[model samples]
Structure formats: structure tokens, C-alpha cells
Target: MEELFNLTYKDEVEILKDEDDFEALGDEKYLNHPDMEARLYWAFCRPNGSCEAQIKDIDPLVSIMAFNHSKLNALKRFTLLHKEVIENPNLRVKIKNRTRMLFRSLVDDDFKELNKVLDIVPVFLEVAVDQLKNGRKWNDIFADEIEATIFMQKAEKFIDDSFKEALFFKLKDLRELDQEELKEHLEEIIEKKEKIHTLILKHYKNEVDKWIEKSNLHLLQKMTIKKLAEKLI
Candidate 1:
């Protein structure tokens, strides 16, 4: 799956290359979904801008970059737009060349890494959605599976490929399994190797609306998150 922005599981990324591409993706019904419409609005409408110039005068490259920027949660987009450059330094230079003042005003930093903004959104999103402030990290859960897999792998005669798959996915809970001796052995491995998730939740923003209100965050970071939040909230 290759979703362009935040979504990781889409089968093919739908790139809005131009007016025609946007028209194809959008409809009256499409507007019903807040996120889709927000993406479209930020990407095309650019509610922040007040330009009335002719389409021919606007650089096409700027539109593409802006839309790509829109894919990031608004606040995060702002972060990368200023704090980090695009995957390419050239694209940042190109956008700066075209837009000139708007971006220059928002973020003046020269650093850029594609998806620098995107990476932070999910960290907050999971904390908010799942309320995972005090819990095991998912990677550690997967590590338990790894421990079990290594132990089981030694017994090639008994453990089949399907069993290995289930073990990896934790499709069935190992804790309740009937094999007590193997379970104890696996539990011991987990005890020694497992890492704990953090107790402190860095994201104190209870409402998505409040994410931008925190003063400790960089201004560009707040700007990026705030813009995306505006569309949905």
C-alpha cells in the first residue's frame, strides 16, 4: 500500500498532478469526509492565500509542492517546509523561487528531509487515538514473537510454517496456549529482552484543537499541525 501522505495502507498512491487529477478525485460526496476535503482544500484552494492572478502566471511546480506539503498534517508540513527541506534540496529551492515570499515568511531554515513533518504526526496521533501513554511499544510486542520464533525454530520436526506465521503475528495469544513448559520458556525470554513503553506522554494536547496551543513546540511545528487540524476540526 502506498498512500501519499499519512495513510500507510492504500494500495496505490493517488497523486493530484493537476486540475484534471483533482476533479477526478473529488466530488460532492468526497467533501463529506473531512480529511479528504481538507487535503483537497489545503492542496488546491490554499485558503491562506489571496492571490487573484492568472493561472498562467503561477508556476505549476509550486502547486505540486504545495499539494505535497498539504499531505503532511498541516503543522508538520510547516515544520519541514521551514526546518527541513524536501527530499531534494532542488525542490525546496524551486518552490522558494516560485512562491518567493509566502514560504520565506513561514519558515526560513535551510534544513529539509522529506517526511520529517509526517513522522511526528503519527506519534501524536497514536497517543491521542489509542491513549497509549503507559503501555508496551508495539515493537516490543513483535519482539516477543521473535523470541518465540527463535525458540520454536530449533524444533523443525514439529513447528510448521503456519505455526510460525501465527507466532509472528500473535494471531492467537500465546499466554493462554496449553503448552505450559514452552510458554514458560518463552516468557523468560520476554522478561529478559522486552523494553517498556514510556510512562510520560509528551503530547499533552487533549483535543486535536489544542495541539497548536502548546508554547514549547517550535512555531513552524505548531503552524504545520494547526493547518491540518483546522480542516478537520
Candidate 2:
């Protein structure tokens, strides 16, 4: 097993080195390379000859290699070519599994780095629902007020005097909540506390729409509007 692992690692390294050489020779040479053609085919072509894998088990280095060797047109092509892979149920499951494993491995010092990539709105909603149901305050569940505010802006529809007072008291205590545990709690909230759903959806729709417009997120705008309309049912 050790020898096999080493061999696989060496192969990966060679592929990366070859990719660098191909890239330096200009786009024409890179595009004409037999190895590039083979790698693209293997990465994209479906096992059953039906559809390509949008998300492959290939290393990130290989993906970066492809990116460096090609232009935006190539990147766009690669992205579109793998759409089916990304949409595949098995691939999504694998992605989720890997993501959970990675999240679990994060240390205390890694939280800042993790937060940069995480879309905290959903996480905040999960936590907020838990706090509201348990009659807890935001400060009781979060360590940072700025983080709490960001969460509130994304998830909360109304911040009344009572809620503010409760949050203020909790802030003094400085407690922390697990995001995943909060998600599980939110499932219960969805079933037993339907009113919160309306509030959450309302908040999500209002804030996300404004954000999409400001950011010029045309695709997200269309999707969010469609979802908002569907929520009426």
C-alpha cells in the first residue's frame, strides 16, 4: 500500500510538472499536447459514455494546471463540460461527505479561514431559530457582536426592544453554539414553529434580493425570485 501510494503521488507530481512545461510553451502548444487531450478526456468523459463528471476525484493541483494552461474560454468550456458531474447525485453526496470531513478537521485557529468561505446566513438562521425557540439571546449563542449583526441582518426580520434586551444580556455572558447542532435544531423548529419559517423566508427574500441587485448577481436574482414565489405556496 505504501509503495502504491508513493507511485500515485509520483504520477501526480509528474503530471503537474508536465502541465507547467505545456503552459510555458504557449496556448497553441498546450492545446496540441496529447497528454492534455488525454487528461481532459479522462477528467470529463463519463464512465458509461453517457455524460462527463463535472466534479472529478482529481487533485486540486491538476485543476490548477488545467487553468494555467488555458484561457478564460477554456475555463468556461471546462466548467460547462462538467455541469452534469456537478449535478450528479452521487457526486453531490461525495462532495458533502468530503466537506463535512474537512469541516470536522478544522481547529480553533482555522475558524477565521473557514468563515471566509462559508455563507453564514444559513448557519445564522439555524442558530437564530434555536435561540428564539429556547428563549435564548444572540449574545448567549455567539461570541462576536459584529458576527451576530451580520447573522441578524441575514436571518432576522424584526429586532424589537425585547429581543434587543435579551440579546444584550446574552452578549454579557459570551456563549457559543455549534452551527451543525443548530441546523439539526432548526429542523425541529421548521416542524413545530411554522411561523418562524415565514419570518425567515421573508427576511431571506428581502435581504437577498437587495444584495443580489447590489452585487449584480443576475443568476441568483432569478433563482431567488423564483424561490420566493414558490414559498407563497
Q: Cα RMSD (Å) per model?
A: 23.8, 18.2
In model 1, residue pairs whose N, Cα or C atoms come closer than 3 Å (at least 3 residues apart or on different chains), thus clashing, are 74-224, 75-224, 75-225, 84-111, 84-112, 85-111, 85-112
TM-score of each: 0.19, 0.25
Task: Put down candidate 1 lDDT per residue, 117-207, tens digits, no spaces.
Answer: 2243222222221112222223323333233333333333444454333333432233333334323433443354333111101111123
Model 1, runs deviating above 4 Å:
1-172, 175-185, 188-194, 197-233
Q: Distance (Å) between predicted and true CA of 138, model 2?
A: 25
Query: What would the per-residue lDDT of candidate 2 be over residues 1-233, giving only the tens digit for each residue?
Result: 24434444335334544454533322332223345433543333222221112122143322333333332322242343233334454533433433333333221121232333234213323334334334322222322333434444554564665545443443312113233333343343334433333434343334434443544346754564445434432
Residue 118 in candidate 1 has what lDDT?
24
Report the poorest 10 consecutive residues by lDDT, candidate 1: 196-205
Local error of candidate 1 at 5, Å? 32
Alpha carbon deviation, residue 10, candidate 2 (Å): 11
